[model samples]
Target: MILGTVLGLIIFGGIGEFSKSQKANSLGQVKYLIGVSYPNLNGPWQLQMNKEIKNEIARHDDTRVIFTDAAQNDEQQVQDIHSLMSYGIDLLIVSVDNASTLTPVISEVYKKIPVIVLGRGVKGYDYTLYIGSDNQLNGNMAAKEAIRLLGNKRGQIIEVEGNKESLQAEERSKGFRETIQRESKHSIIETINGNWLKDRAEDELKNLLKSGVKPDLIYAHNDAMALGAYQALKQLKIEGIKIIGTDGLNEESGGLRLVKQGIIDATYITPTGGTSAVQYAIDILHKVPGLPKKIILRNHEVTKSNVDSYLTEGDNSSIPFIKKKERKIKLGFAQVGSESEWRLANTDSIISAAKEAGVELILKNADYSQKKQMDIIRDFIKQKVDVIAFSPKTEDGWEEVLMEAKNAGIPIILSDREINVEDQTMWTSFIGSDFVEEGRRAGKWLVSDSKLTTTPLHIIEIEGTANSAPAVDRKQGFNEIIQQNSKFQLLQSYSGDFTLDQGKKWMKQALKTYGTEIDVVYAHNDDMALGAIKAIEDYGLKPGVDIKIISIDATIKAFNSLKLGKMNFTVECNPLLGPQLMKAVKDLENGIEIPQKIITAEETFDQKQSKKEFSRRAY
Candidate 1:
């Protein structure tokens, strides 16, 4: 198949050659080659996406897209990506085939160039950006539609699934099953594998019906499969079964048209994000600042009654517009606490940025109390603030409060820290540094320094606040890198609560217990590392010389300590998120879709580099 595709490319005068000729036609002009990988082009849904992408790119003379169809083969998709790379494509856009298998390959590609993942997301934060729909919500919508179709009657459901390994398939199945179990008097009696193809869905459903089992309702993961299931019912002379599907494409054979023709009852319009993906790809290639990590397009339900309105395409005549009220946008912000220099700098940046943006700011210091932060958020909701932003002290226990905020129609932006919540839609967006990457940088520095000697180095760790996002993610990231080398021994770890006192106390206890066995000390923040330095001095040992110190948060004090030969290395967790946060607040007020996760730019510093970069330290 690969050879055939290559030969076909040659027969068609080769897109790469065409691009080169185009580039040559205009001297000194820059042209970007974008590679688009699709799982298959067998269905209207995928074809529509390809058409939309091509149309959007046609508007840009400087960009050319080379598309590849994997024909629903996972290995073929990986090979196609390599082939595209061999052609020297500038960027890649992939609609993942199998997330489990494709994540590693995509991540490897991301190491070299920008990759835009569409439709389905892979395992990790390796890609440049993800543009896709909320498949789980589509599943929820499908379940609700199924319930409405039953309308006070209990029914058995037959679910026609797509590729099992696909993230979209898994999430859709999970959302549908969980919702049915929780809210409706319906049970999914049997699940048939469709593999996201019409013929396979028909064959599978026919086999299931041949086994003398029947269902009152059919829910397919996509429209093609839904249509196949409907055909199976027609062939088997089965009637009165309500059919629901996803991907409400408006093509002649799409879900919208199918619903209009009474072939399927309802469908959730899962936007392909093709046009948006192209736009974002251009922006990314241009190095646009403040772009979102993930753009989640909205999905709406389409049925026979509303299918005509959707078929009209771009008609906003029936939609009502509300006039905006001119007033200062009220922003309620809650700071975790001033436990360290970094925390103080972070708080000051937000406060100052809010003021500069002409936003009415109601700022509160949680003082390391999650309860206090929740109280402040509740108060913000009560005051009917336009926007609420807070840095969570810990990763859990914000679900109830956030749900309340969501119920009150208030948009929440998470600042600096993240939370562990099931309903992610409770928060609009998260703007913070990548904590895991910071930990990985610290671990990487330690690994690189360890090359100087072969002896096993025993390390002591002073962690930040227990169960906090930074502490947990940093530990995980550090461990991920250190596990690669067996010579690094982690002696012990202690929580510092991001406080200098706790850091000093923990370091003193570790020194007293382990004495000189500790070869290196890894602190989660600059304050803790400073405290560890004090404890090392009290222990009558050199800090940078005897026990090399590694920490996060490159405060001026840490830089000074590095200059004074007290701290060895400090990974920077940039705290200046003021501009980004204020911009997000204003954007949210203007009803813009914010990216799911916005990562702040950061870097690392060592003892020598610290002297040169010290003057540039803002936090």
Candidate 2:
């Protein structure tokens, strides 16, 4: 079977030269060489496979795992396979870049050494084994739920699909449309291409809405699209429309969390099966009987009712593990100075997490100096630490120094503030609160209550440090939300340098400029809000009553203010990221894959909830 009709790579040339130069081991052997080619190492799903496969390889004494990334290039994958075979790899596990273009290599490689195709299937390839979930079956399962949502009544389903070129998109779409047509009266009114991106899905769904279709229910091929579709309809004043999604990843930013938070109605679990794939490979190596040619791991729907089983916070035992090492992990953390209570909390969170995980953390405060931060990072490199993490002072001027660290073989993690490096591979992972979403939550809370929406509410935004990611993105998100309603007006917005003193001075100026006209004080953090509260009191006005105070970073101080009726509302920006960072570092040490961007889950709080949450608040 020739799955690839377009490829023209010559595999025989390399095989002959390599065989002449080196001795190929016989079939029965004590040692084995396992080669795996991942699609790319950036995504959460891809990282899971990398983790599981590497873990499986680590469990064996005589096995050596050789890894190469196709980096989403089909041609490069062909070259990578030939390179692996040149080293006489005993077995090969490949998540092909493109099933069609890379099928020729799969056909050639399986004949020499056993090959296990990772995720997708080629059209006409007979591989040694196939271990992955069937997207078409996942789509059919989604349709089954859609039928139940309709309950034998007629309704419309708007599907936000992945890219049209993708096989997963085609299969999921075909299965869904066929099932809907055959089993139920529900019709797919519109199917738009999202390119498998959240922003694209939002824009496409908005364009679909412009054509005047308020769907009865929506089924997105992925969770990001479903979330985007939800956001689009929400902005258009549509509510209560059920949405279903795929790839129920178990992370803070993934579909399982979305289901837990009620952001999306449902999502299907898509397994990485890296461990299972490697296990089957080991099984075949030992000639275990009754092994199937194809293995489809089961996937199920995750919704609000059964989401706790998939929740990370509720269970500490589920934290991903690596093999125990003799040396305690040595980590260097560069903080952006103690500018506010939030910074203090974030620093404490990192330290506490390090302490709990038994990691020896070397701490340094850059005092908001980009040069000083770079120097501190270089000092870590000099110490030859196991890993380095930092909250960058600014976005720019990081590419060169980061490249140096990467060259030195130190994995870097960005904590809170992001860097604008040219090459993204310079850093390992970014684990922090999404500042834009934090701002959106604040603005959404401000406008949610009907009583506050009655009149034109003039808002004074006390921003964070100038040009910092949190400051810039928080302003952007807040402005985007408040601009939706004409009743909300931004009277004045200025950066307070994310300091309490600056916040007080800025508040005084804003009050002087607009006397008795301020209806809301929207500070980017709790420290600034506390400063504004002091200014309000000094000016002979009661805080929270005269001016409805809304802020971000629900720290203990902010919660205390809320308890005292000094602060009305605050959105949470959790800074406790030690555990998450430790997990990534451990995985990196063991040659596992980690996501490019890891976001933390947060919540919005009113004065009433503050009373109950103040005691247990860690940040």
Candidate 3:
């Protein structure tokens, strides 16, 4: 098998050359030593994950990987990581056996080197990047398939679960139970732990059957467990109970083959993301642009109808549903008003990209009003546009209008912001910068820059529009870092509405109230930072010298200010998302699924780097 061949290479330490340069040849290509930590390699799923990571790393010549297995023991995993650290590995790729027990150690290690988490993630955003399939969605898909298999009649289900310590198992079961209860006439009557083993599932099923409880359907957390239940049914001369499972592996003895042989009724394709982990590790090491904090792999359901195509095509979920004649995709984009240079650049990028991609763009500006944005979306729905994209004014109140778009069969893509909705599947994907990470980068710059003194530093913040995703997330991310250090003191924050006028007004008030007491000014965007600079200069104080200024949204204006030594630091929040948005729209039109979140590449700049980087700024 491919996995077996890869395993042989991994064991023998026979690294190969790159099959294809994954990215542009990075400068200063250092031979990096990489460490991989695995929970266990006991099952086909685990083995496949290991194989993919090893195979991907083998393609790159400038990297060497050393792996350690924890044998499913959390303590042993901790020890394995410590050993890997002792080797001074440049990066760490880990799949935790248990999140709760391993998070502290992983968090500690992240402070030193980049950590890429796979399968299960740690407690907080302590790692560099995470690549995994959504486990909750896995259960949701299984429950959906169960409802379809059971049809109209109410059905009783027996659920065979994985290890109790596994967060994936808990989330999968929770999603399955909650979805079945809320969306359909189905009940999970009996829940038993199979410990993620086929034999265990078989033994547990025999006991459940002997107890004289008959279920209409059996749902297992994995394909092995589902196949185990099938074995129990065969031994007891029982039939007619539908089976659903997760991890639709394509091997001969895997879920795809089993379903093809009429063993399991349905299975969800839960990707391990092992190859993605390695590929993204290289990207992170190379400091690639436009990398997201999280990459949620797409998952789909496989049944008798599409299993053959799924197996044959490998990645295409369903055969492109009856091909339509080539036509321009009409994309309705409801933008947050051109409040600043960043917003205008974002709008221009979208328009230009739409033209380049041949998409018929129906654009509307919300003018900084959530109500107006909702009206625009309603209008788009009425117009029956092919796709609707919007940068939400606020995170709330979007669920209802988004539901309207979803019900209208038009996919919604969130641009430059996010929304608070009960069902996240309401939107197809979110494409933007990680506002939280941008804030974190700003904070990190302030703490590390040698110009800032060790004494207590007083900070005044000029914020964006209230309740907006960027404002809220940026505050949380910045505060998370600054709160750790006692030297930084945040005096007061002013709400600026992300406008230069409001920023200047608030800065004037702050200058009158606090006077020369403020040592730093943090603005959410470039216009606000410029406004603060004007306020400081008007108050007879040099902007970047007297008051260290930091801001987000690294626009050309911000870059120029950085070069002029007016703004000390500016975090880049790229507004040029037109290319990515158009690509996603075209992919959806072609019946291809995109990731749940698509983050733009961003960076930070100081005065020294501004001149060199200024010429390359797209926004």
Highest TM-score scorer: 1
lDDT per residue as tens, model 2, 288-395? 743445555546677787789777533312122233468888889988798877888778878887888788899999998888989999999899888889998877
Scanning candidate 1 in windows of ten residues, the lowest lDDT window is: 314-323
Give the Cα-based TM-score of candidate 2 against the true structure: 0.53
The local distance difference test score of model 1 is 0.85
Cα lDDT computed for each candidate against the true fold:
0.85, 0.78, 0.84
| Model 3 spans with C-alpha error above 4 angstroms | 1-6, 10-39, 48-130, 134-270, 274-293, 298-323, 450-455
Worst 10 residues of 3 by lDDT: 18-27
Candidate with maximal lDDT:
1
Which residue pairs collide, candidate 3?
Answer: 290-601
- Output the lDDT of residue 375, model 2: 95
Total clashing pairs for each candidate:
1, 0, 1
Q: Rank the candidates by lDDT, best first.
A: 1, 3, 2
